[model samples]
Target chain A: AQSVTQLDSQVPVFEEAPVELRCNYSSSVSVYLFWYVQYPNQGLQLLLKYLSGSTLVKGINGFEAEFNKSQTSFHLRKPSVHISDTAEYFCAVSSFSGNTPLVFGKGTRLSVIA
Target chain B: GAGVSQSPSNKVTEKGKDVELRCDPISGHTALYWYRQSLGQGLEFLIYFQGNSAPDKSGLPSDRFSAERTGGSVSTLTIQRTQQEDSAVYLCASSDRDQPQHFGDGTRLSIL
Candidate 1:
């Protein structure tokens, strides 16, 4: 089984400021890394994914995550944030192959203040 | 034309009552998944279905919970004699087994 832990539970940042959300995983086998965002009363939206290839993977809305194999971490970063970025962020992991279920972290609430 | 959709966006039931939640996946998605989200808790996988076959049900909390997918499209999660702990948001997602999943708004189930 795979497990993920996001370091922060709440992050309040001023708009246009840089932000980073740390995530670490525990798994004996290889797994896929993913980051999803959820707004109020809505389901999650995929932000970025780390399948293979480039260590740094970028996704929608200026979000990026770097896959560090040695540390078993895939941390999401954004150079600048907007107030619209305020939402609950989740880091999830699953097996690279087979029918594996996603194991998610508790969640990190990003409050982008103006 | 539409994304994953779930019926009865909000459901309120008393403890000991049975409740069913429905999920309609994308037209061509071959894989569907069900997850539960409780207050202050992250999304927890409950069951998985791929092209009409299910191989994972380990995340289901107990035997009181069951789910079935028909025609590889629509799925229903049923909770028998629901308990207070059953209150949470139930989410449905669908993919083609190789693509990113699309999710529904989810159905919030509240047990009184």
Candidate 2:
């Protein structure tokens, strides 16, 4: 089984400032990582994914995540943020193969202020 | 449809009542999944269907919860004798094989 852990429950940042949401995972076998964002009363939208290849994966809304295999972490970061970026972000993981279910962490609510 | 579609954007039912939620996966998508989002539990996988066959159903909370997919297109999740604790947003997602999954707006189920 795979599991995800989001270190922060909430993150508050000012517009144009950088932010990072921490995530960790545990699994005996290899896994794929993903980040999804959800606005108020909306469904989740994919932010980025780390399937394989480059360690740094870029996603929509200027968001990116670095997959550190050694640390077992895939933290999402944004060099510059906007007020519109405020939303609930979730870190999810799945097995590298098969019909594995996506295991998600407790989301981190990002609040970007002006 | 352009994306996954879930019916009855919001549902409010009394305790002990049975509720059924529907999901229509994207055309040609062979994989469909059901998840629940709540304040306490966050996002929890409920079920997954791969062309009408459920290979993973361990995420279902209890026996009161059951789901079925037919014709590899539509799916329904039924909760028998729903409890207040069942209140949450039920999300549906679909994918093509091992590709990224797209989500629906979800059905907010509130049991009073």
Give TM-scores for every candidate, taking all chains together and pairing residue i with residue i: 0.97, 0.97
In model 2 chain A, which range of ten residues has the least summed lDDT? A94-103
Residue ranges of candidate 1 with Cα displaced over 4 Å: A97-99
Model 1 in CAPRI terms: which quality? medium
Evaluate model 2 with DockQ and give the value: 0.64
A1-114 in candidate 2: lDDT tens per residue?
788999999999999999999999999999999999999988999898888899999999999999999999999999999999999999999885325678899999999999
Evaluated at residue A65, the lDDT of candidate 2 is: 97
Q: Write the per-residue lDDT of candidate 1 for residues A20-82, one digit (tens) a residue.
A: 999999999988888999999999899988888999999999999999999999999999999
Q: Please report, in order, the local distance difference test score of every candidate based on alpha carbons.
A: 0.91, 0.93
Best by DockQ: 2
Q: Per-prediction TM-score of chain B?
A: 0.96, 0.98
